[model samples]
Target: MPRININLSHQIVKKFGLAEVDDFGTSPEFYFASSVNLPKNSAFANSMKSEVEKYSFRPTLHAPFMHLNLGSESKEIAETTRKELQWAIDTAAFLRADIIVVHPGYTALPEKKTIEHTGWLDNALPNLDFIAKYSEDKGIKLAFENIFDRDPFSLLLIKEAIGTSNIGFCFDTGHYNIFAPLDMQDWLEALDGHIYEFHVHDNDSTGDQHLPIGEGNIDFTSLQNYLVSKEISELPVVTFENKTLDFVKQSLSRIREWEFLKT
Candidate 1:
């Protein structure tokens, strides 16, 4: 069965406590979405590590993504991006996390016709190479997630250019429902072997609402069928990115009913 994880930030854990997470019977995917959430000192890091260890939970991490552009043309912006990502890698290593999720740093703009025209890959290559090697050395995998990408091609390009097993894709269902120009099946096929994890949430296709699975129109049954067809020996980590505990529990119950996940 795929390892189940729930997305929680430092603020969330501080507010609700890990006992609630323990009750849910799922590991956590710690989301450090901003610099404020990143641990500032060893004491803070050790505290979190101790709490997580107490529960015997193996964690994953979501790197800071706000206003971070790995492909930025500005030298300062590029340097800052790499620095923050390196911080995430170091934190993940300290926490003994299996992988850290990263944003691909692409957004749709009117001036650019395609990713190549935007030069995102070109500007991002050096930083991507650096981070990929750095994370690999720490025994951590980088799962580049889809944000404003219109299709799988941009991520595919990154994978091909980086050409490293330590780097893989994290398919976000809500992002795909809202931002992807192609269908879910197309994404699954294109990123077939490279999928390392999933940010599973649902939205109405009108917005990134992060609703429970059944409340939205995403065809999760198709996702299950794809996994079954592949006869995968190891399933990717499934992290619920819902907004609340109720939604996470709802998604958990819904996914547990899926035949492929039941095994």
Candidate 2:
């Protein structure tokens, strides 16, 4: 069985009534720590590293997404974004993370200077290639996650252009529900073998609710069946992106029940 994980930030631990990182009992099989929770400084990362190691929890990283666009047409902004992402990659490596999740750069198409969605390929490819090499050198994988993408075809184009084993896909369920024009199966079939992680959350088509699994319209049974048939060779990391510990626990229980019912 693929290990289930939860997204944890400093705020989440605090909300759980825990005063310190160690105070929170380590029951989660894995954790996806937000880059904001992990600053780009060594001291902070090192401090948390001890607590994580003590629990024997495998870790992965969610790179800072806000304003960190690898596809920015402006050279200066793109360069800055690249550096910031590099820091994230380095920090992930420092923590011995198995993989780092990132957003596929977005574009406002029909811009006066840029080449629609394809323009993202310009800056995004080179920077992704750079990070791919960096991750490979550190023995970690980099998974580009989807957000606001209308379809998977554009992502396929980017994936094909890169064509590196170091780079993989991180499918976000809530993002697909709210932002994608197509269904989850369409996206799954498009990136079948390359999926390394699943940001498992729920939302209605109208908004990104981040609700517990099985609460909204997404059919996890269908998703699981597809994965069993298509991606059985690899056990992709599945991280619940619910906001609170209560919701996260509920989502995990829901998944467990679903798995049990399937059996």
Candidate 3:
């Protein structure tokens, strides 16, 4: 079966706190709910993590995206990011989990230093080094995700520099919806053995609407074909990162009943 996971956002947990919404069937990919409780205090986060433990589903945690950036330009911001990620790492360890999905940061300022992308790389590589060593010491596998428009070489280089058995890539389908330089198939092929997991969601291409499968324009069939070609279908675990509960439930149902995997 294709491993289906749910992105556990804080919003859903808040609803759970109010009145538990029972999950009747299995949620394939237990995508940790970073979108919902991203701004909560450590105590609150721990509480949510406890709730996650209550579920019978298997989980993969995504580090929070707010107030931190792994790919920050400023050294101070970068160090702060290191600390923030460490918090998530510690949380995962406490939760007795193995997988942690993380984003690759980006630079957006026009007036920022023209370090030529490679120069920007010089400053960021050290941060990746710190994370690689830290995750190793903790005995955790940190899956660095591939996001679009962010420097591609930077991600590849970081993967090379932070050489460890615990590190690999978490390919997000929506992010690939916008991947530059290489086409999506080529990109998927390049990361074949290196891909540790996936953030599965669909978008309209114009915007990241996080639509459930078959509702949006993402060609999941084609994507599945590539996964089969790579022999990834066996250990498949895809976290539906959509926000709507209805959509999340629908995504779970469709993936469980997906025709792509049936044949």
| Candidate that scores best on TM-score | 1
Q: What is the lDDT for 78 in model 2?
A: 74
Prediction 3 global C-alpha lDDT = 0.64
Model 1 clashes, total count: 0
Pull out the clashing pairs in model 1: none
* Candidate 1 per-residue lDDT over residues 59-95, each given as its tens digit: 8999988878899988898888999999999888877
Q: Give me the candidate number with maximum lDDT.
A: 1
Model 1 residue 124 distance off true place after TM-score fit, in angstroms: 0.8
Report the C-alpha lDDT of model 3 over 1-263, residue by residue, as the tens digit: 55566676555555554123335344422334343444445666676556556764455677765566665667787887777677777766665656788875664423322324436556667777787778888887888777654334445666777667778878777876754435667766666667777788888777777888777777776567665565544454566777676887777777766555675
Which regions of candidate 2 deviate over 4 angstroms? 13-43, 108-117, 230-233, 260-263
Reference-based lDDT, each prediction: 0.85, 0.69, 0.64
Q: How many residue pairs clash per model?
A: 0, 0, 13
Q: Rank the models by TM-score, top first.
A: 1, 2, 3
Worst 10 residues of 1 by lDDT: 108-117
TM-score quality measure for candidate 3: 0.80
lDDT of 3 at 129: 78
Report how far off residue 21 is in candidate 2 (Å).
10
Candidate 1 displacement at residue 190 in angstroms: 0.7
